[model samples]
Target chain A: MIQLTDVTKQYPTKSGPRTILKGINLTIRKGEHVGILGRNGAGKSTLVRVIGGAEPPTTGTVEREMSVSWPLAFTGGFHAKLTGIDNLRFICRIYGVDFHDRLDFVKDFSELGAYLYEPLGVYSSGMRARLAFAISMTIDFDCYLIDEVMAVGDDSFREKCKVELFEKRADKAMLIVSHSHRYLKGTCNRFLLFRDGTIQEYDDFDEVYEKYKELLAEPQTF
Target chain B: MASNSLNSSSEGSFRQSLVVQGRVLHALLIREMLTRYGRNNLGFLWLFLEPMLFTLAVTALWTATRTIHGSDLPITAFAITGYASMLMWRNMPGRCINAIKGNTPLMFHRQVRPLDVYTSRILLEFGGSSASFVLLVMAFWAFDAVALPEDALQVVVGWLTLGWFGAGLAIVLGAVSEKSDLVDKLWPPFSYLLFPFSGAAFIVDSLPDKAREILLYLPMLNCVEFIREGYFGTKMHAHYDMPYVIVFNLVLTLLALGMVRMHVVEADYE
Candidate 1:
């Protein structure tokens, strides 16, 4: 279970302090797949980052009874100068998981073959995403925070991700943030429409998607 | 009743959290080594080799130049002790100042804290420099260039005190550098200015009475004096107050902890 109480995030801008999240109270229980939809700059990514325990709220508390994974498809955590296998080993060590046991799995799943031994900085963006996705899948977490960047790679890789995340690990909770309405409709059990530094939840996905479209059509306020 | 259970659970989880932190630090240390040294030629050996090379160059230069201070100590031994001690305290804060900002993405992992980053870098610097110091002394002894330390325990204690002082200062600088660029701009010149007075180049006893009194207030000076006394023993008079160095380190450590806590609280994550 994950709970955020009175969470607000603000960033210092040249003009002044810009408030990203005004005041957010959210809770996600086990086995719930939540999809967050928002227009550009609506703070969707920021909200997921807060839920994943990456960013601390300006003024609030986060309570977690379950282990949370880093944002899926995030390649930033890896040291660019290190080999892909070395990066995986480091991540496994930090998570207290045996890298020796999972080594074969990540190597095979990433499908980069000999490239895994090369430095991550040498890999293309698509290969890096594949490696990141494979590593995230190898580590078992109670909740996974996925950003839209998971859409990288070929069609077959997307299918592989679907089977691995949705079919193989159907019981795990997830908070997926994306701008793709069709993708959310297929994956999410519930929907969250983010706007004006706040989130509105809807059980029926179609209703929220329509409202989201309407909001997009209106002129954005500063 | 709910609050009671919550408090108990949190208390129970404290030990678990520490275990998690330990694992994270171990991982970070390995990552630091891999990135810093790489896998190919002379990997990891560079940790000690780098410092040893620097000390060797300085020692050779002093020996060749015959730069005699008022001390009877061999120029080679003097250079080794002084340069090694200076590197121990000086290199740490230089490495730590921007460590967190450079690895901002690592903070995405909840187990990795700003303190962990600082601690790992500081430990690496301390460990590498200390190893180099010991190896240099042993090599010099084997070649009859320098004698064994008069009191091994005193040398160890002095080195540890210097390490503590360096770690404390590094934590404070690292934390402050996160909030402002002023530290980044000023630290290099400030460190250079402090180098002459660090007692790395001259013995405290060699100074005049008034200069000696003022130099005693500097913790790095006291550390160097203690270490030199251990090596030179009765051959030269050494003056240092253990109580003064200990008290200064303790107070600085406390202040550093407070500043680090503030940085963690105010750090902006992307």
Candidate 2:
């Protein structure tokens, strides 16, 4: 279970402080897949980051009773100067898992045979994403947090991700933030629409999709 | 009944948090080593070699110049003891200042705190410099270039005090630099200014009475004096107050930890 109480996030800008989230209260129980949709600058990514414990809220509390993984396949967590295998070893050590045991699995899953030994700085975007996906999959978490970078690599790799995350871990809870409504419709059980620093939940995908379309069609007030 | 269960569970999680922090620190230490000193061309050997080279250059300069200040002691011994302690204390804050910004991605992990980042850098600085100091002393003694330290216990204690002081200062600087750009601009000039008063070049006993009294207020100066006393023994007089250094370190450590806690709370992730 993950719970957030009165969560607020603000960033200092050149023109005073910009408020991103305003007193958000949320709870996600086990086995619930949540999809978050938002237009540009609507704080979808910030909300997920706060939920994943990557960033602390400006004012509020987050209580996590389950292990929460970092945003899946996000390259920000890997050190570019280190090799893919070295980055894997570091993450494994911190997570208190045996790196040696998971090495073969990550190598086979990532499919970057000899590239794992090379520095991550040298790896192409696709290779880095593949390594990130494989490592996140190797580590078992009660809940996974994913940002918009889900559809990485070619068609085959996308299929692999869908099978690994959706088919294999069907029971695990997931919170995904994405602009692709079709992908969310296929994956998520519930929907959250972020607008004006607040969230509105929709139990039905078609209903939320209509509302989302209306929201997009509306002219910008500011 | 629900509250009771919540309290018990929270207590259990607290203990688990400590274990997670330990594991994260261990991982960070290994990552620091690998990234800092890669597997090619002398690798980890450079950790000790860097400091040894600095000390050797300074010692050679002092010997060649014959710049003795009313003291009959060997310039090599004087230079090594002073410069090694200087590097141990001075390099730490510089290394720590922008550490978090460089490893921003690592902060994504729930278990990796800002404190862990500073701790790993501090450990590397302290460990590398401390090892180099010990090795240099041994080498010099073997060559009959310097005498064995008079009191090994005092030397160890003094060295540890210096490390503790450096670690605490580094933590504070690391957190402060994260908040403001001014610290980045000011620290270099400030550190250079501090070098002279750090007691790296002269003994406290050689200073004028009024100058000695003021230098005593600087904890780093006391740390250097304590170390020199251990090295030179009764051959030279060293002025340092142990209790003052201890209290200074304790206060600075508490302040550093408090600053780090604030940084973690206020940290804005990208």
Best by DockQ: 2
> TM-score, each model?
0.93, 0.93
lDDT by residue for model 2 (B1-270), tens: 001111124344545767776788899998888888886758778766876687678778877887755366666677677778888788899888888877666766766778888888889888888887888878877888788788888888999999999999888888888888777788889988988888878888888999999989988889888988887888888899989989989999999988887765344221
Candidate 1 lDDT, B1-270, residue by residue in tens: 011111113343556766776787899888887787788748767766776687678778767776655586877788788888899888899989988888877867776778889899998888888888998888888989788889989889999999999999998888889888898889999989998899877888889999999989989989998998888888878889989999999998998888876656343231
**Model 2 regions more than 4 Å off:** A218-222, B1-18, B265-270
Query: DockQ of each model against the real complex?
Result: 0.45, 0.49
What tens-digit string does per-residue lDDT give for candidate 1 at A91-139? 8888778898888988878899999999999999999999999998878
The regions of model 1 sitting more than 4 angstroms off are: A219-222, B1-15, B41-43, B265-270
* Clashing residue pairs found in predicted model 2: none
Residue A78 CA displacement from its true place in model 2, Å: 1.3
* Candidate 2 lDDT over residue span A1-222, tens digit each: 888888999988888999999989889988899999878888898898888766789988778777777889988988888999999998888878888999998988899999999999999999999999999987888788988756688888888988999999989999998888889999999899988889999999999988888989988652
TM-score of chain B of 1: 0.90
